[model samples]
Each structure stands twice: as C-alpha cells, then as structure tokens.
Target: MRSAITLEPVVVTAPMQTSPLRVVLDPKRPYQPVPASDGADFLKSIPGFDTIRKGGSNGDPVFRGMVGSRLNILVDGGQIGGGCPSRMDPPTAYIAPELFDKVTLIKGPETVTWGPGNSAGTVLFDRTFTRYEKPSWSFIGSLLGGTRGRFDQTADIRAGTPDFYMGVSANHTRADDYEDGSGHRVHSSYERWNTDVTLGWTPGKDTRVELTAGRGNGHAAYAFSGMDGVQFLRQSLALHFVQENLSETFTKLDVRAYYNSVDHVMDNYTLRRPDPDSAMPMAMASEPARQTRGGRVAGTFDWGDAVELVAGIDGSGNTHTSRSGGPEGSIMGYYRDMPRRRDATISTVGGFSQLTWYLNTHQRLIGGTRVDWAHVRGYALTGDGDSGSLSMGSGMGMGGSAPETTAASRSATLPSGFLRYEHDLADTHATLYAGIGHVERFPDYWEMFGGHVASTVTSFQSLRPERTTQLDVGVQYQTQRTQAWVSAYAGVVNDYILIHYLDGNGAASNVNARIMGGEAGVVRAIGSHWKGNATVAYAWGQNQTEHRPLPQLPPLDVKLGLVYDAGRWSAGALWRVDSAQHRIAIGEGNIVGDDLGPTGGFGVFSVNGSMRLSQEFTLSAGVDNLFDKTYAESVNAISKELQGYTGAIRINEPGRTFWAKLEVKL
Candidate 1:
C-alpha cells in the first residue's frame, strides 16, 4: 500500500511581487489570479517591459525601445527562436512559464557573462532541483477556466531520495477569440501544450549531474496578419554538472551543454480560410526551422573573504533552413514536394571573467570583460533551391530572381566590458550603484538574410555590425515597512538595424540611434492588513541618422495597486495608466514589427480575490478590464486597414474578463 500525505497550503502573494522593481520573477507563483497565455504576456508585470501584440498569444517582448537580437533570451542556458521571417512564432511562444522555477532579467549592456550581442538585455528561465534527505514524492496541479472559453491545465510531479531524483511537468492551454468592449471579436485564438522531464544523480558528497529534455507544440490564429502560425514545434536537451566546495581557493566548478530546435509552419489556409481578393489570392504556406547547440565551462574562485571571481568560456552554433509550397489553390503535397534549403549559419565562441571586490562591509566594486569571435555565412542556390533567396527576399520584390550560386562568410572579433561601484548607507538602509558598458553586436540572420535592401543588393552582406555604449545608475531602499527602487540607462547605438515597412512590404537597413529609459517602484505596508504599491516607466529614442524621433518607442506608463489581507483571505485592486505618444517616424522599426503611427493612451482597472480552502487546496479568481474600457496597445504596428478591416482602427483589447483557478498540492 502507498502512503498519502497532505501538503501545506500555498500563500497567495501580490501578483507582481517577485523582487519589487527588478525584472526577475518567481515562475512558481500565480500571476494575475490566472495563468498568462505565453511568456510575453507575463512580462508585462515588469516595469519598462512591453510586448508587440498581434493577438492573444505569442507577442514579441520589447525592452525599453529595442527589439530583435538586441535582447538575449535563454531557456536553461540555451538559445531558441522561431523560424518565421515575420516572427509569427516568437521564442516566448514555446515557454510554459509555470514549468520553470526562476526567471532572471539583466537590463542593458551591463554584463557579458551570458552570450554575445544583447545590447537591450538578457532574460534567463531556469529550473533547479533539490536533494531530499529521505525518499519522498510530491505533486502540484492547477486548473483554470475563464471568459471566452479559455482553459488551462498544468501538473508537476517529482519523486526523489538522497542520491537520485526525477521529475516531470506537463501543460495544456487553449482559448477562443475574445470580444472587445464594443462586442467585436478580435480574431485571437490559440491552443498549445508542453511536456518536460528531468533526472538527477548525486554521485558524491559534493558533486551532482542532471539531464533535462522537453518538447512543446502549438498553433495560433492572428488578427493582424494574412497568415497564422499553423505549427510551432520545439525540442530541447541539456546536461549540467557541478562540483561545489572543491577546495578553499577553488570554491566551485560548473559545466553544461545544450541543444534546442524549433520547427515552425505559417500558412494562409490552416487557421483561417484564404482571402481570395487579398495579397496572394491563393492558398500559400511556408515551413521554416532552426537548430542551435552550445556548451559552457566555468569556475568560481575565492580569494580570502573580500574577493571573488567567476570565469568561463562558451560557444554556440546555429543553422537555419526552410521550404515553401502550395502557392495556388492546392494544399496537398506541400511538405512532401518541398525540399528543405539551408539559408544561414552562425557560430560564436567567447571567454569572460567577472570579479566582485568588497571594499568593506558597506561598499563594493564589480567589473567584467569579454572577447568573442563570430562567423556568419549565407548560401545562394539556383533553380528550385532558390526558395532560400526567394522566400527570404519576397517582401522586397526580388524573390523571383536568384544571383549566381555563391557562398559568403564574414568573421569579426568583438569585445565587451562593464564596471560598477556600489555603496550602502547603513543608517538609512539604502544602496546606490552606477556603471558604464559597451557591446558590439554581430548582425543576426533576420537582419542579414530576411529582406533585401534593393533589387541591386543581394543579401545584407555590406551591413556593418552594431555597437552600443551605455551608462546605468540605480538606487534601492528597504526597511521593515517599505521598499523602493529606481534604475535608469542612456545609450548611443552605431549602425542599429532598422526595418522599414512600406505599403505592406518591408526591407531591413542600418542606421544610428540614441536611446534612454528608466523604471521606478515603491511599496509600503499601510497597516497590519493593508498594503499599497506604485510603479512607473518611460522611454525615449531618436533616429540620429535621420534627425527625427525614433519609431516604436513606448510612452510613459504607470501602475497602482492596493491590497487587504486577513488571515487566510486576501483581496486586491490594480489600476494601469498610459500617456499618449506623439513622437513618431512613420516607417522604421525592428524585425518583428514596424511603427505604424502615434498612439493615444488609456487606463484600465482590475480586481482579484483568493482564499485558502485547506492545507492542500486553494481557490483564486479575478476580473480584468473591470470597466470594459476599449483601448489598443502602444507597441503594435498592425492597423485595422492592414488586416483588411474598415477604417484605421487598431486592434482593441479584450473586454471585462472573468477568470478562476483551482490549485492542489500533495
């Protein structure tokens, strides 16, 4: 007979209280009394972060005023990206947030420890396994149902002993198109599922090895594009080993290797019927895929108690391929007749060293430097294989013709570094810090191969690498009853990649730009049962090359929250406000989507409640857009006219949405 155990009830904290104003988050916590459709939607809780939305799910994450490869996003220390040139399936589409334990965000070009590029920031979703003193089994499950036929199911189970452990997690989520405040459907519907497994071995007293494997697949319907993501398939594998407390001087050694692959399909006939009078006037589909493999070896060194150092060498390589078929009425033989063609290949190797020097109990200094060698190559094919160039250059009116068979490879050695100083005001319980850094970013595949500059230009072979220099400053204050933080950054980018959208077609180019942004938040405990909090974020940018305001920059935004807690019951209210953005440069932006025009802002209010039913169960519910105010997101580029709708309307958000969730632990 098997023994059944009761688990403790989960404490429901504030929706976005991971670390005050910082971008990090605890993925295990419930967000908004319900679960988000994807990782991008969940990032909205962080100040200074926003998403480019075309529908309910798979929105592109935007940090400050930057997008694309400027941001380094990783899952379990590995990189993965959708294959769509138009970004129908972003990297976040594959991540099931609650499956991971921790999510960390490093803003700006402040560090060089992760990978190359990353001028905007670095995002890491990580999972950690704990050792058990005795044999035990644990399980956690959540089910959610909400307005618009939304449904979600998630489960996490683990069994472990002192020397070995294993765990598995599975999730499934689905939703129908939601209606706007005015009772109009937004054409946003999606279904997705993911499963992951892990195994760990504690071979010695201070050594451990772990292996992880995961697979995820999904489909979505878009409101802003003629085509939708018909298939989003992902596979991942990773191995990690650590030997801690090795010696007095050499504190720890760590090594890891990982592989990630994404296979995506986009078409006009899968999710919705093809529009006979639209762009193609026929059924069309394209299949694109990418594979990435990487490894890292690092060690931590300690010099007495005042100095510590972490140094490592890492490398990664990726290949992008695609095939297209069914341009006319027939949908048959699309995959079998279409042959895959290689389009791009990129590889990079780098070494870095970061050190922390404690100047005393109340002060410290930190610095780091890195050097990377990168190689980028593109292939041109003749005849049918020419789909590589045709599909890549379709938007620029250069698809039908292919340059003579040719192969070009470019190489560059880039260096990046940062330095910062910190001081603590013990009496006031506050800390202040400042830093400056510079990074050189190699052009990514989307920038180099996705679109052509002109009929005379083949690939973006002549494009220059981008370089950014930035200064960051911040302050943090904490006490028994209150906590607050403020962070800001300003930077100049040389040879920034910009995509120009014209008459439904687009092209990629390079230009100089300047950017600045900051975020601030404060939280206070009003009484034994009350709490209040507020946060604000703003960003500004300029197209230095064109002498005009940069496009796609978000305007000033603010959020306020009030909460009441009594024993096992809790309730809260949240309000969000945004300011109109008048700054505009009509046609320039990043690869994901371009700036359509200036946008007016609006405010929204929501309320939530939760109750602990028992030691092993809990219930929570919430209503978003409580007033049912209609508004459009500021970062979106698709206009109602662009999506074949009447007038110049923007995609309106969902109306008053009611949602409830049940959680159980055993």
Candidate 2:
C-alpha cells in the first residue's frame, strides 16, 4: 500500500520484538487520556475501540469487528487468562498504564511472537528500562476529582545508573454512583490499586536484561448487570533481554518470559441482588472462587532491514470451586476447588517471519507468514452435570467427539499471511500504500463447552475452530494546508462462531455466522497550536444462511477531538457519538446471550490537560463523560439484572467519572 507521504517522515515503528502499531503521546492529543485505569478502558479512546457495558466494571473491549478470545492480549509478552471467566475484571482490569512505557496494537491476525489464535489481532503493553549515565533518581505524581465523587492518584519513582536500573509505581481510583444527563442514578463505585517493580542490567553496549513483578486488587458495582464485584486479585512476573545492532545482518534480538495469575471472588447478596427472599439460594457471599495461572517465553531476531522472525511457547491452567456460605455469601454450596489439571492447561508453540524489501527506495514491498501449533487439554470436575465427552466441530462440518474422560486431547495448527506495497513520489512530499491479510484462529474454551452441546459430532466436536480471509487498504495525504488518512476494509468470515442464549439459565449454544465492517480516521492540523482528530467506523454481521444480523456487532460510531499545545502545557476536548442500533436479536440467543433489542444512540464529551513540572517530571488529568451521560454499551448474559439475589454479580459501566496521572524521568 502507498500512503501519501507526510512532510515529516515519522520513524516511530516499534522494535522487531514487540511490533505494536506505534501510538504517539502528544500531550495535546484530544480523546487520548493518560494511562487508563485498565487496558480496555484506555482502548475506549481509540477510534474503533468500544466496551460492552454491564455496569460499573467488566466491560469487554471490541476492536475492528472482534471481541473476547478472538483478540490476544499480552503483558510484557506473557499471554494470561482474563480474571473474570464471566469477565468481571476483564483482562485489561489487571493492568496499570503507569507501569508501561509503550502500548502497541497489531490489527489483524497476530504474528508468532504473541502465541496464536488472535483473529482480531494482538495488543502489546510494555515498560522500558531507560539507562542513566550516572546514578540518578526521579519521581512523578497525579491527583484528580470531578462530578461524581471521582478521585484518583498515581506515583512513580525511578533510579538508575549506566549499568543498572530500578523502578516502581502505584495507582488508585474511585468514583461514587454517577448521575446521568437525565438525572438518573447509575450504579458506579470502583476503586483499585497496583504496584510494580522492575530491575535491569546492561552488561554491554548492546545487551540488556530486566526483571519485573506486580500485584493488584479492586471491585466495582455494575450499572448494566445485576452483580457487584466483591473482590479481585492480580499477580505477575516478567523477565526480558535485548541485544541491538548485533551485526550488519541482524538488527536486534529480543527474548522474554513471564507469568500471571488471577484470583477472583464474587457474591450476589453483597451488592444488591434483586431477590433477597431466597432463603436456601442465598450464598454465603463467598461461595465461589476461581483462579487461573500461566506463563510464556519468546525470542525475536531482526535481520538488518529486510526480515524479522519471532518464536514462542506458552502454557496455562484454570481451576474453580465454590463453598456453601463460604467466603462471601454467593450461593449455598461448599466445594473447595477440585484438583484441577486439565481446565488449567493450554500449551502452545509458534513461529513467524516478516520481510521488507526496498524495491528501489522509491518503491517497496512487504510480505510475511506465521504458523502456530497449540495443544489444549483440560478437565473440569463438573460432577453429575451430564458430563459426557468432547466434540471437535459439532455445529459445523469441521471434526469431533471424544469421551469426557480425564484425558482429552485437541491440537490445531493456525496459519496467517500478509502482503503490502508502497510508492514514493519525488514530485511532492507524499507516498501511497496498501495491503491485504488472511488469518485463521482456533476456537476458545468459552466457545467450546460454555454454551452449546451436541450429541454425536467430530473428534472433540465442541472445540471446532473457525477461519477468516480479509482485505484492508488505506490512503494518507499531507499538504501544507491539510493532513489526513483514510483506511477501509471488507472481509468474509467463514464458520464465524457465535453463542446463542435461550434464557436466564445460561443454556447457550454455538452457531457459525459471518461479519463485515469499515473504519476511518483523519487528523487536520489547521495551524500552529490548533489540531483535530476525527474518526468514524461501522461494523455489520449476518448469518447469511440463517438471514439474520450477527449477535453483538457494535453500533456505528464516530469520534472528534480538538487540541492545543505549547512547550510545557497542553489541553484538549473530545466528543464521541454512536448511531442507535435497531437491529438486535432478542430471541433465543446463545453464547453471548441476549442481543437485548435496540441500544439507544448516545454522545459523550471529555476534557483533559497536562503541564510539565520540570525537566524530568510531568502532570496530567482528565474528566470523562463531562456531562454525566448515562447509557448501556452492549448486553451479555453476565450483565443479567441482579435485583433479587442480594449478592455479588456481574453488571455494566458506571456513570461520569474523573482521572489524573503523573510521570517522571531520571
């Protein structure tokens, strides 16, 4: 693809090791808030990023046209399970933006470095270790409060020398139930804190190694769903190595390994379960607890300016057990987690190569391929719940069934490809570029046994996978008077799996469907100190054979932001809008549950500002939903109204809130 060249060639691409599409932080950038409360939360500001609101917490992030397991998220290169299986905490909840120096997103089928099965794409969040010429130290902090009892704080301290470095950071946030534009009180109280430490060593001019660890906890009352969060925990560790410009042939080499664990607790009676009269059904508030643990290792080699290769391996396991009147009053039951081995194991090995050719400087070509082999074998002690067996592709013409014994094995090989072209013009400061990509992903566990069940199917019939082939293209133009870029894409998803929910009993099943979408963003830099970014996106899905709109396809959305910046201070305002969704499936929905009819259209405004405190420190703050807008993002089963059970349950997004953050360099 050829992009209209800009006056200035922005060289912001990430290193070969973590290839995230680069995001520049121009303090004045509107819509873009400082480090977000969580990974997904921060993503909301991105043009095509949206969250399905349940209540105060646990919003699932949707990108391009994919959500849930289709998108792969990694922390320092480690693939970890999202905390809430029901997604109360969502994977992004465990992250603190203050801890990462860079955030990168690879849109579309992922490369081998991030493991596999990410048809939606891969996101990489990382913290870099900056070296110092001599022993030095610095500190940064932030404070904020606004409309709905909103308040937040963050701090970071760093010390380092030419040969060694150490750094640590902590953050906290809270908000009272918010009042919407219509003067409606929305459920929305959330508070959380996290601390992380990193130590690094630079043994030579081109070599470096680092170790990092962190822990966090929090809870939120959902507004969209019926449940309130009782408790959540996150712990992780990571190790990294970097070698640069190793030789004329190899530009760099990177290797990393890491581990992550989530311990979660919930109850319906604790917050505001609707049914308080349930005598026997009343859980002790802590009857349920679930945990997942796992780790991964990967290596990358950058071949000068032409080729790059990444390879990795990973594994994980999950276990869940509940007790009657146990921890918090959740449900009346007593069952310490059973010895879990299978439900807790997911192992994968993969490799990918990317190539770039300077087809005569004025012209260039890019092509790459990736492959991954994953073996998943897990067993859950479902007890007497019709525990039958494994089915590979039950609903589709895939493959299938195996006895639901202690040992069940399923292996899948995924392949992906990409190609692109760029042309430079000597007549003007401009270039043009275009590209296409195809990717296939294995079905996730949630897609497996969580919903549908079949009698006689293929080997491991429940695990039937899906494949996709797509094409994307864009144009960028820059002139003394204007700077703009537009990208569009269309794809056909074959065997797209979707969960169908019949009612409140969580009896869900799967159906293969199709989906399509398009997105575009443009920035116009009027003049010195005046700038704006505008984006619009729309996505659609249909069960062509079934002749119905696919479930949970995000509504059409648009974003606009204006910003002003100076040497040390910056300010901005952002507006977000969405078209009313009238095409929703209200019948026997499966996997993702209710399409909950039509979602009303809504608009929200946000404002933010920042100041440089010194040569080494900076401060920033912002207020979201400035007008305290009230709306539901998307509906999922976990978001069921919890008015009766008087305990912790899953819900949706909170109301208007504020946030602040600070950073320092030494």
Candidate 3:
C-alpha cells in the first residue's frame, strides 16, 4: 500500500473510497462515544454492521448479513485463528483496536489483492510506522471508568530518530456482569489486557523494515454458552519490508511474514457451577490451541500515470489441537494432565493481480483476479469410537451435536475475479460506480470438523467449496456542507454451505442460495456548530433448496446522529432503531446458531460530550442506552440462560450505563 499522511478527525463522515461500500477508519479518533472492548465493538459503531453478542466482548461481526470466512479479517496483514471450536474467541477478540492506526473495510468481493474467499468483504487492522524528521518522543494515555465496575486504561509510547524508531502500546479493561433494563443481572463479565512492541529501521529514503511482537491474555464470562472463556492467551510476531520507487515502472515492492498462536481454556466450573443434571455432570475443562503462520509478497507496476497494476502471492497454514478432562474439581487444572491430540491442519496458497485503468479524469476501470489452492487434513486422534466426539470440522462444536471423525485429506483449486467501472461528476462533486465479483470459498476447519461423517468418508472430504457471484453498485455525493453515499449488492451462491439442527442432531450440507443487501448514509453540516447524519441498512436472503428464507438474516436497521462542535467543546446524541424480523428458517443456520424463530425489534438512544482542555489533555463521557430500555437485537444467537428465561431466548443488552474517559498526550 502507498504511504501518505492525511490530517482529519476520526469520524464517519470521511470521503468515500473508490470501491463501493469501503470504509476506512482511524482508530485513534474519538468518534465512538463508548469504549470498545475489542475490534468488534468498534465495528458496531459503523452503519450496515451488527454483531452476534455472547456477552460484553468477542461478539461475532456480521456484514451484509454474512459471517465467518465470508468476512476475511486481517491484523497487520496477518490472519489469526482462535482455538475454540465454539467460536468463543473470534479473530477480533484478540485485537485491541486502539493499538492499530487504521481499520479498513472493503465490502463484498470487489477486489482480489488481499486473500481468497472474501465473498462478504474484508477487514484490515494496520499499524504503520512513521519516519521521524528528527529525534522525537511521544506518548498517549487514557483512563476510563463506568457503571457495573467497568474500568479501562491504555498507553502508547514512541521514541525515535531520523532513521530508526521503536514503540509500545498496552491496555487493560474489565467489567462486571451488568443488569438489564429490567433490573436483572446477566452472566457477562470479563477482564483482558494486551501489550505490543514495534521496532523499525530505514536504510534508505525509500526503504523500510519493521518488526513487531505482542502478547495478551484474559478471561471472559459468557451469558448464553455452556462454557466460559477461562483463558484467552495470544502471542504474535511479524516482520515487514517495503521498498518504494524501486524503479519508474516498478514503483513499489512489499513483503511480510507473520506468526500467531492462541491458547484457550473453557469450563463451566470456573465461572459457574456445574449443572449436575446436564451431560457434564461435574466440573470439566477443555483446552485448545491453534497456531498460524503466513507470508505475502507483492509489487506495484505503473505504465505511465493512467495505468497501474498490483500483483501478489500469499499463503497461510494453521494447525488445531486440544485436550480435555471431565468430572474434576474446579481447582484441578485438568487441562495440564489431559492427553493432547492434534485433530486438524489447514493451509492455503494463492496468487492475485489487480489493475486500474484511468480513462481520463471523469472515468476509470478496475479489474482483479485470483486463484487459490487449499488443502485440509484431519484425524480421529482418540479413536474413541464415540460418534459423539466433538471435532473442529464437525457440527457439534457450537450449538449442534458432536461430530464423528475419520482420518482424511481434501484439496481444491478455486478461481475468483471482478470488474468495475467508476464515473465522476467533478462539477457536482459526485461519483457513481458498479462492479461484479465472483468468489469460491473452501470449507474451513470448523465446517469440516463440525459435520457428521457421510458415507464411508469423513464429512471433511465431502464438503465442497462455496461459490458466490455478486454484483455491486453505489453512489457518493459530497459538497462543502453535505455528504452522502449509498451502496447495494446482489449475489447467487452455488454450493452454499449451511448447517441444520433437527431432532437434536446437526448436519452440514451444500445448497443453492441468494442474498441481497444495501447500506446508505447522509451527513449534513448544520450551520457552523451543529451537524446531522442518518444511515440505513437492510439485508435479505433465501434458501433455494429449502424454499424458505435463509436463517441468520439481520433486520433493517437505522441510525441518526446530531453533533455540536465549538472551539474546545463538543457534544452528540445518537438514536438507533431496527425493524422486527419475521422471516427465518427454523433449524437452519451457519456454525454460529440456527434461527431462533421470530424476534421483536426496538430503538435505543445515547448521548456523549467531550472537551479539549489543551493540546496535551482531553476528556470525554457518555451515557449508552440512555433510557435503560430492555431490548434484544434482531441478529442474535440463542442465550444459554437469560434473566430466568431459558431455551433459545436472545440475550438482553445492557441497561442505561454511564462512562467517562480522560486522555493525555505528551
């Protein structure tokens, strides 16, 4: 990526990108009134996005009503996978957004430069190194306190000279179980901390090399799942190199290598008492570990000033292993004694190229293509003969039945591409664009290990790659005082992979499906001191094979915001509303969960204020769910238990909560 700096406030009103629906966020900004526990919470502040909340943090993110591999997420250009088969720890769960410099979201399969199978879109959290003109040092720190014993602290420090630099960032956050609007406490408490360090060397004016390392560990309580995350430990390392202006035609060359590992432990005994009547009659614990390694090499070529090309090859490999023990005391730490078993290994290698043709100043054309080779191997490590053994590719890891496994290997070669045309109305400060993209996604480890064995072969061998063909269109309008944008997509998926639960049994299968969605927003500068903005998003889907509405489809949602800004003071109010959802396919869903019948929708309101005390100090505060209204989101998973209600009920959101924050820069 080209390196450049732009000074602007971190806000939702930034100018639109060349790609439709793409949003680039500045993580250092104060636009989000609430403190985000992780990257997922930060995404929730954007329009057209929603999360499947398990509790206060680690909620699964949904874009255009799509989840999982559909949304390819990367941190510092590397992928990180959690060990939990239940997705108790999603990729974002390990990411502390504040530590990153930028978060970019490319909605849909509009480009092929990243990795493969981003049919839903792509999310990138990046931290870029800045060269110092002279010897310098800087620091940023923040402290937060809120209701429910909520508290957080963060610090970032940097010191460097003209040719070298180093920095470190760290944060800690925790919260207790919060009461609902109805005055009932839910099982949602968590504590987390992370620290990252970076070192950089610039040998030449146009060359740079950087190294990064980080470690984090924490535990979180779950309100809807059988087991709580007793431990979430992560370690990461990466090296990146960039050479700009390598030549006139070959303008840039970039390469990177990274390693990430996660150690996770889950147990009912540690966070809650064992349910004697349940299958796990006594305290039990499951420890899982995943290791991922990957690298990418890319270069940019330019032909004159009107045409440019970016080509690259990227590959990644990951292995999953686990150990478990049952019916032990809460203090036993059974994971250490349980036998460790390697269950699965997955890998992918891909090559891609993207081209841009600038046809005059008013029009442009862009195209991209990618090909990937993916492989998966698995084993029945226990040979337990228990068809009910939980496995990664099997259906039972989340909310389904245990999966039977067998030693197996599978491989697939898939191709994907897209073409787009963009037109600019310079005089009117408006732009219009349209594109069509196709992506073939291989079955992930969880999908393979989560499915039941079919025939004499393991389900991992029978599952096919999901194919998505999509068309996207959008328009953006901007002026001195007003900005607006709208984007839409329609797609037909062949061999779409879906899981179903029937009669207490879960199975994975392939089917034909259709999906469509769009998001639109408008921001108007109201006078000099006030601004107003509104946005709306909606998604729809259908199961062609089942002749029913697709499951896990999110309801139409909207947001309205008004902000007032003075020299040193600013305040804002936000209102969010969602329509009720009645369309759902019972017993059918993805790895997350099946549709829980119909759900009612509600609206929420919040207020925020901030003061810029000086160049080095600032303060902010807010009240979320201001009315303390009891409500549940339309796109939600089943709660294991909620406010005395059980059996597939949606988890309630936190009631009226207040928080304050103080920030300092030196």
Best candidate per TM-score, number?
A: 3
Could you give the candidate ranking by TM-score, starting with the highest?
3, 1, 2
Tens-digit lDDT track for model 1 on 1-666? 844333222222232323312466777656652467788876766778888877778988888877778889888888887687667777888899888888888888877788889888888988878777889999989898999999999999999888999999999999988887877788789999999999999866588899999999989888877677878899999999999998899998989999999998877777778787765556777788899999999999999979999999999999988877664446545553678878778999999999999999988888899999999887742232232321322221222443555567788999999888888988997888888889999988777766422212343466778899988888888898888888888899888877776655455667898988898888888887787889888999998998988888889989888877765767888888999998988876677656768888899888888787876778878888999988887787344223434564467778889998888989
Model 3, runs deviating above 4 Å: 1-19, 31-33, 326-333, 381-386, 389-405, 451-458, 641-648
Q: How does residue 649 of candidate 3 score in lDDT?
A: 78
* Comparing 1 and 3 on lDDT, the stronger one: 3
Give the Cα lDDT of each candidate: 0.78, 0.58, 0.81
Off by over 4 Å in 1: 1-22, 327-333, 381-405, 451-459, 637-644
Question: On residues 1-666, what C-alpha lDDT tens digit does candidate 2 reach at each position?
Answer: 943222121111011111122233321111243234566766666556676655444566777656767778877777656533355656777776655666676666524446566667777777667668788887765555555665667777888888999988887877666554556565666777888989999877688889988888888776544346666677878778888777765556777666677765555555654444432133333323334455554455555555555545555555533332333232323323322222424555666666667767577777767776766654532323433432111111111342344445577887877787767667775566666767767666555443233222232445456777666565555666555555556667776765544333333233456656666666666677766777787877777656787766678988787777664677777787888887676653433345767777888777777777765556667777777676556544444444322342323233455665554545
What is the TM-score of candidate 1? Answer: 0.93
1 versus 2: better lDDT goes to: 1
Please list the Cα RMSD from the true structure of every candidate, rounded to 1 decimal place: 4.0, 7.2, 4.2
Better candidate number, 2 or 3, judged by lDDT: 3
Error at 302, model 1, angstroms: 1.2
Segments of candidate 2 deviating more than 4 angstroms: 1-35, 224-226, 272-274, 277-280, 284-344, 381-407, 425-431, 451-460, 478-482, 505-512, 564-571, 588-593, 607-623, 626-628, 634-638, 642-666
Winning model by lDDT: 3
Cα lDDT tens digits, model 3, 1-666, are 943332222233222343456888777665543678898888877777888888878888988888888899999999998787767888889999888889999988988989989999999999978788888999988888999999999999999888999999999999999888998788889999999999999867788899999999999888767678888999999999999998889999999999999998888778788787754556677788899999999999999979999999999999988877643544434556767788889999999999999999899899999999998888752233344533322222333444454677878999999999999987888889999999999987656664322212445556789999999999988888888999999999999888776654456789999999898888888887788888898999999998999899889998888888775777788888899999998877776667878888899988888777777878888888999999877767544444344553788888999988888989
lDDT (Cα, 0-100) at 607 in candidate 2: 78
